[model samples]
Target: MIRTGNEYRESIRDGRQIWIDGEKVKDVTTHPMFKPVVDVRARIYDLAHEEHSRKVMTYADEETGEANAIANRLPKTQQDWKDKRAAVELVQREAGGVVTRVGDETIGEMWSLYDGQDVLNEVDPRFSENIRRHIARTIKGDPFHISANTDPKGDRSKAPQDQDPDMLLHVVKETDSGIVVRGAKYETAAAYANQAFTKPTIANWGNDKLSDYAVGFVVDLGSPGLKFISRNGFAGRAPAADYPLANRVDEVESLVVFDNVEIPWEDVLFYRHTKAAAFIRSTLHRYSALPFVQRTLHLADLMIGSALWNVKQTGLEKQQAVQEKLAQLACYREGINAHLTAAIANAEASPGGLLMPNQSLLYTGRVFALSQLPAMMHTARELCGGQICITPDSATFNDPEVSPWLEKFYTINDNWVAEDRRRLLAFARDLLNSDYAGHRLTFQLFAQSPPFAQLGAVYRNFDWSGPLDLVKDAANLSEKVNGSL
Candidate 1:
C-alpha cells in the first residue's frame, strides 16, 4: 500500500516518549521544533504518490511484487543503480537542497539488506517467507525515521566494549519473545521523525563478553520503554518573522534511550554473531555513502546558486574577483556532481544482487565532500561579505517608522530592490551565521567518519601503487631521453 502523506502523519499521532528542553513532548507532530522536520518528511511521502515523482520515488519489489519506497528496494543491476540514484536526486532536489542528510533513506535500506541476510540463514524455509513479507511491509509501510548510532560517547580512542560499557547500547537480557536492550544511542538525527525503524549506533562483534551487545532489532517509536531526549537546532526558536528558514528547517537531534526495551526475536537481525555484525556495518557504510554523495552534490548546487544569486543581487557579478569566486563555487559543485556520476556509472552488482557503487570512488567522494563542504560554506560567507551580519531583522525593516530610512540606506545597486536584496542577505546570514548553519557544517564534516579517520580510510582504500607506477614509468622515460642525448 502506498501510504499518503496524511496517512503517514496519522500513523504517528499517538503518544511517544519524547523529551525536549527537559519536558516531555505530548504531541510530536505539533511540537515547534519537530513540526517543520515532519512537514519536510511529509513532502517526501507526498512525492511518492505524485504523478511526476511516483515513478522515481516508488519501486516495485522484485520479491513481493508490491510498489514501495525505492530506498527499500535493493538495486540489482546497472540500471538499478541509475534508478536509485535518480530517486535520491529527486528527493534532494524537491527539498531545495535544504535537506542535506542522506541517511534518511539509506538506514532503512541497510536494515532491509540485513533482514535479507537473516532470511537466508534461517533453517526453516517458512522463515524466509516471513522475512520476505517483513521486507515488503517495511518497504510499503511508513517506518520510523532512521539515524545511524555509531558515535559512542566519550574518548574515541577506546574500543566500544573497553570504554565505559554502559555508554554503548548493549543487550541486558533475553526472552522467548525478544531481548532486553539497555543504554543509549547518541547524536541520532531523526529520533523525532517516526515510530519505528530505529536501531543501534554501531555493530557489536560478539565475543563472549560482548555477546549480549551483538543484538540488532527494530522497535516502534512508542514502544514501552523507549525514551527520546531532543536537542535544539539553531532555528528552533527565532521569532517566525526574524527567521523564516529556521522555522521551516529546524532539525532536532535526540539521545535515544532504551531502558530495558524489549525487541522481539523475529525482528532481531544479528545476535551473538560478531562476524555478521561487522559485515552489516561495513556493508551499510559502503552502500549508504553513495546516496550521501548525491545529496552533498545537491547541497553544493544550492550553495553555488545561493552564492551566485547573492553576487548578482549585490551588483557584484561583473567584478573580476566576484566572478572568480563564483566560478570557484561552481567548480566545487561540479566536482561533487562529477564524482557522483562516476560512482553511479561504475556501480557493480553485489553477491545479494544489490548494486553497489565502487568502494574506492565512493569513499573518495565522501572524503572530498567532508573536506570541500566547509570551504564551500566559507566561500559563500566570503562572497556575501559583511552584508550578511549587517542586514536588519525582517521585523525592523517592516516597521513603519524605520522602514524608509533603512531601505534608503541599505539598498545597493539601482537595479536591486531593497526588500529583495534584504531577503537574500538575510538568507545568507541564516545560512552562514546561525546555529543551524554551524550544525549543518559540523554534520557534513563527520557524517561519514571523522576528518582524520576519513583521510585514513581514503589512504587505506586508495590504490597508490598504480599512480606510483605511472610516475615511475614517466621518470624512466625522462631518464632514457637524457641518456640518449
Candidate 2:
C-alpha cells in the first residue's frame, strides 16, 4: 500500500538521534531547524497519494506485486525513462525549484538504482528473499534520502584506509544479530528525511584487514546508537522572510555517527564482496545525473522568471541592454533544458532492465550546469542591482511610520506596489547574497568534482577526438574548395 504523508511522519516521529548545536532533538517534526525540511518531504509523500500525481509518483513493482514510489522502481526501457522523467518533474514542480535541495533529487535517484540491483544472492543466497523483501518495502514506503559520503578525507591524496580510520564510516565489530559500525558520515544532506538508507560512499574490497569496513546495510532512523548533528535549526529563520530560496528548500548537512550500531543481517546489501563496490558506484553514476538536470531546469525557470520580472518592474524592459541580459538568462535556461531532453531521449536500458541516461552526456551536463549556475545568478543580481540589497525587511512596510516613506521611495511601475517590488528584490537578494547563497555557489563548484577533475572525467568518457576529427575532415574539404583563402 502507498503510505500517506501522515503515516510517513509517524514512522519517523520516534527513535531518531538528531542533534542541533549539541542538544539532542526530542522531536524532528517540531524542531525549528528540521521541520521545514520535513514538511517538504511530507509534501512528496502527499504527491504519491495525490490523484494527479499518484500514477506518476508510483508504480506496481513486478517483484513485490505492490505499488511503490517511482524512485524505487527501476526502468528497463525507453518508456521507463520517460516515465521516470515524468515522476521527477512532478516532484520538481511541487518543490517550486526552491524548497528541495538538488542533492535530495540526485541521491534519491542513486538509491533507486542501488535497489534495482539483485545483489542479494551475490552477498548470501540464504538472505536473498529477505533482502528483496526489504528493498521492495523500502521503495514502496520510505522516501529514501541518500548522502554520498565521499569527502571524509580532508586531504584528497589519502585513501580511506590511509586516512584516520574514524574519518570514514567502518565496521568496528560483528555481533550475532548484526555488525556494529562505528564512525561518521560527514556532509550528509537531508539527514532527517530518511535515516534508514545509509550506506558506504565508496566500494570496499574484503581483504583480511578491510573486511570490517566491507559492510553495507539499511538501518532505522531511530536505530540504537545512531546520532545526527545538524549545523542549523529549521525554525531559527523563515525562508520567505529571511534567506528566501536557500531557506525554502535548504539542504541540511550533518555528521551521522554510528557508535557500535547494530545492522541486522537481513538489512545488509553488500558484505565482504569487494567486487560489488565498483558495481554500486557505477550504477549510481548512471542513474543519478539525469534527475539533477531535471531539478536544474526548474531552478533555471525560477531564475529566468525572476530576472525578467524584476527587469519589467524596474521599467528597464524597454532598454536594449536589459533585453539582452534577459535574453542571456533565457538562453541559458533553454540550453540546459535541451541538454536534459536530449539525454533522456537518448537513454538506454541497463542490464537490470532499468533505463538510464547516457553517462557521457549526463556527466557533461553536470559539469556545464554547475559552471553556468553562478553566471545565471549573476544575471539576476545585475538586473536587480542595488534594489536587491536596499529592499527593506517585510516588516518595515507593515510599520505605519515607515510604510508611507517606503511606499513613496520604493515604488517601481504604476502596476506594482513599492512593497511588492521590494519583496521581489529582497527575494533576489536572499537567493544571491545570503549565507545559503554562498553555500549553493560553493556546492555547484564542488558538487561532482573539482573543475579539472570534471573536465578529465568528460574527456575520459566522451569520444572528443571522434567528433573533432569529423569536424576537421569537413573543414579540410571546405578549404580545398575555397582555395585555402
Write down the TM-score of every candidate. Answer: 0.87, 0.85
The sequence of per-residue lDDT tens digits that candidate 1 reaches over residues 256-280 is 7788889787766566555544545
Q: Name the top TM-score candidate.
A: 1
Q: List where candidate 2 sits over 4 angstroms from the true fold.
A: 60-67, 99-134, 154-163, 187-190, 199-211, 447-453, 468-485
Whole-structure CA lDDT of model 1: 0.67
For 385-435, candidate 2 gives per-residue lDDT tens digits of 876776678787779988999998888557998867877877677667777
Worst 10 residues of 1 by lDDT: 476-485
Residue 318 accuracy (lDDT) in model 1: 96
Which residue pairs of candidate 1 clash? Answer: 149-201, 195-221, 206-274
